[model samples]
Target: MKKACFCGTFDPVTQGHLDLIQRATRLFDEVVVVIGVNSDKHTMFPLDQRKKWLEESLKDLCHVTVQARAGLATEICKEIKANVLIRGVRNGVDLEYEKNMAAMNHLLDPSIETVILLASEDKMHCSSSNVREFLRYNRDVSQMVPACVAKDLKEGGKA
Candidate 1:
């Protein structure tokens, strides 16, 4: 089984993320969407809430599963027995950042290979940080995020 792991904070999974995961599903037998828990960083959404939103957004992807872990992504990949790491690159900056991270991950676990996928033209501009900022100002993020997440953000009255 070729299992790939896509790890991110996913404070609120955006359309770009969904697009990448959906594409990954076709390449790997199973794709594990691991939500990295970083206590040092101030996240807009709670871990459980983020996990729930991801689950709701990706429920239709039968081969994908969501998990929460507090550690290096490489470690999580080892725990899940995933040999591939899926990353989405939006532009040159993202590519540089992901390249460095991939090098570090390779050093930690050479067994796991990192696969970088370019963002689709339509969703290239959608990012979780931008969506969070929009929600903070009570702006509409329905176009950037999944419907379930947009509904939750609206109902939660984030400001």
Candidate 2:
């Protein structure tokens, strides 16, 4: 079966991320959503917490699964036997950035292909950073993130 890996920090999975994963599922038999941790960046939530949030947010998606990972994304893709690397892009800048990364990913593993999915216009501006900032100021992010994540952020009272 054809499989794809959608890797991201998903500090909090935004609606845009979900849009991409949902769209990807239509094209691939299964999609493994990878919550990758970049040591250089400070994450708002822990890996386990992020994993749980993702699991909760994506529970309804039958062909999707979540995994908390650290290290090279290509390595994770290989481990999962994902033939495609899925990424969500919002605009020109995002497109350019993803394109470069796709090239690098190809250099790392020629067998794996990169697919760029554009975020819906409504959710194009929503991002994990935006969610963190909204929560940091106690703004309602119910519209930006999944209901489960919004609830967690409100209850946890953390950014």
Candidate 3:
């Protein structure tokens, strides 16, 4: 059985993230969504709230497991015995960053491999930050986010 890890902040699990997760689930037997927290970074949604959102977002995906972490992804992969690191790329700039990071991950472990997936056109423009921006501006973001997310945003559900 193939196992992989998807690492990110997931401040709010947008449709884009769900797209990637859905795709990853097809190629791997078990895909764990690793929510990493970086103290130096700032996010509109707190980690706990985001984690809760992710949990609800993935409650239906039996093959997908969501968990929170506080450090490097490379370490988590090693600890979990995962050989694949799945990432989603939206465009050229994203490819550049993801390509370099894939190379670095190889150097860090020499055993783990990074896999980059291009998002579908609809999801390419959707991101957590974008969703947050729309919400912050009081704009309708029902199209860019998942149903659960939209409900959360509407019913005062955190992140």
Candidate 4:
């Protein structure tokens, strides 16, 4: 079976990320959604909470698996026997960076391929940062994310 790995910080799982995963799932037999475990950047939702949120978000997607990435995603992909690295790009800047990374991954492991999936129109402007900012100011961000997550943020009163 063909396997792919989609890596991201997913500070909070947004509809954008979900959309990408859903699209990627169609092409690969299985997709591994990797949430990067780098804590240098202060995130509103930590790894464990984010993992729980992602699990809930992806409950219905049987072929799509979720995992926490401790370091390099390519390393995880190699370990998991994934030949494709999936990434979602919104615009030119994203494409440029991904292109560079793709080349580096090829150099590191020539067998691994990088796949770039563009975000859908509805998800184009949505991001984890935007969601967090909206919640930080007590704005309505439910429409951009899962209902359960919205309630979690609201009930936790973290915003």
Number of clashing pairs per prediction, in order: 0, 0, 0, 0
Best by lDDT: 1
* Model 2 agreement with the true structure over 6-122: per-residue lDDT tens digits: 999998889888888888989999999998878898998888888988898789998899987787878899999999999889999999999999999899999999988889999
Q: Could you tell me how far off, in angstroms, the CA of residue 156 lies in candidate 4 after the best superposition?
A: 1.7
Q: List the global CA lDDT of all models.
A: 0.92, 0.88, 0.86, 0.87
Candidate 2, superposed: residue stretches over 4 Å from native = none
Name the candidate, 1 or 3, with the larger lDDT value: 1
The alpha-carbon deviation from the true structure for residue 48 of candidate 1, after best TM-score superposition, in angstroms, is 0.9
> In candidate 4, which residue pairs clash?
none
lDDT of 4 by residue, 1-159 (tens): 999999888878889999999888899999998888885778887788889889899999989888886777678889888999998888898899999999998888888899999989889877888888897788888888876688898798854
Q: How accurate locally is residue 99 in candidate 1, as Cα lDDT from 0 to 100?
A: 99
lDDT of 1 by residue, 1-159 (tens): 999999999978999999999999999999999999888989988899999999999999989999999899889999999999999999999999999999999999999999999999999889998888887787899999999988887787762
Report the poorest 10 consecutive residues by lDDT, candidate 4: 150-159
TM-score for each candidate, following the candidate numbering:
0.97, 0.95, 0.94, 0.93
Q: Give the Å shift of residue 38 in candidate 1.
A: 1.1
* lDDT (Cα, tens digit) per residue for candidate 3, span 1-159: 788999998878888998899889889999999988789989887888788878887888888888888767788998887889999999999999999999888888878889899999988989878888887878877888778778877888433
**lDDT accuracy of residue 83 in candidate 2:** 91
List CA RMSD, all candidates: 1.1, 1.3, 1.7, 1.4
